[model samples]
Target: EAGVVQSPRYKIIEKKQPVAFWCNPISGHNTLYWYLQNLGQGPELLIRYENEEAVDDSQLPKDRFSAERLKGVDSTLKIQPAELGDSAVYLCASSLEGFSANEQFFGPGTRLTVL
Candidate 1:
């Protein structure tokens, strides 16, 4: 099997620094989600927010990763004391209306490198 590819746009930081990625979807979209893509794998769902409420966040690693969608619009994903294994692309996506990931518009992901 082939390894997953990395993105061009990136952030380089020390292993213990805090990092945050922001995303603003197209206006009027309802459902929003964050995903993590690592080497040799597809994008993994992190958290899903319906409006200001997070309907599904079971996949999120609560100890280090956190996300929030304020006023059901712009969102932010933060990582505290990031680890080397945490190096990956963070993706933010939104759909017009639904609990599913269908017809979602995705923002350019930011790949993080923990050195």
Candidate 2:
């Protein structure tokens, strides 16, 4: 209801330094979202965008994490000077409109690890 909710699916997390992931969603979707998944945990919403406008980002940790959907087409999430605690899988998703569990399409996540 608040935002696009993904099913409790698992994403593989491989070790890597720094934090940045890019996602290109299928055409026609107007909403986009970014999520983070820690080991053994379900994904948590980091931000949500409606076209180039971010409509929801309450869950995002502003101190370190940032996200942007440029031109309403590509979405990128970044963690500046990422910390070890930031290690996790970053997920990108899109939906036709707002929050619809069925209309959402997800991309494979990129795992972040700070060494």
Give the per-residue lDDT of model 2 (tens digit) for 1-115: 2333332233223334345677777677788888888989998988999999999899998987788888887777767756667767778888887475556777777766555
Q: Show pairs that collide, candidate 2.
A: none
Where model 1 places Cα greater than 4 Å from the true spot, the runs are 1-8
Which residue runs of candidate 2 sit more than 4 Å off their true CA positions?
1-18
Give per-model TM-scores.
0.88, 0.79
How big is the RMSD of model 1?
A: 6.0
Give residue 90's error in model 1 in angstroms. Answer: 0.4
Instruction: State, as a TM-score between 0 and 1, how close model 2 is to the true structure.
Output: 0.79
Task: Evaluate all candidate structures by whole-model CA lDDT and list the values in order.
Answer: 0.82, 0.73
Kindly list the per-residue Cα lDDT of model 1 for residues 9-106, writing each as its tens digit: 58999999998888877677788888999978989999988888999999999999898888898888899979998899898888877555368677
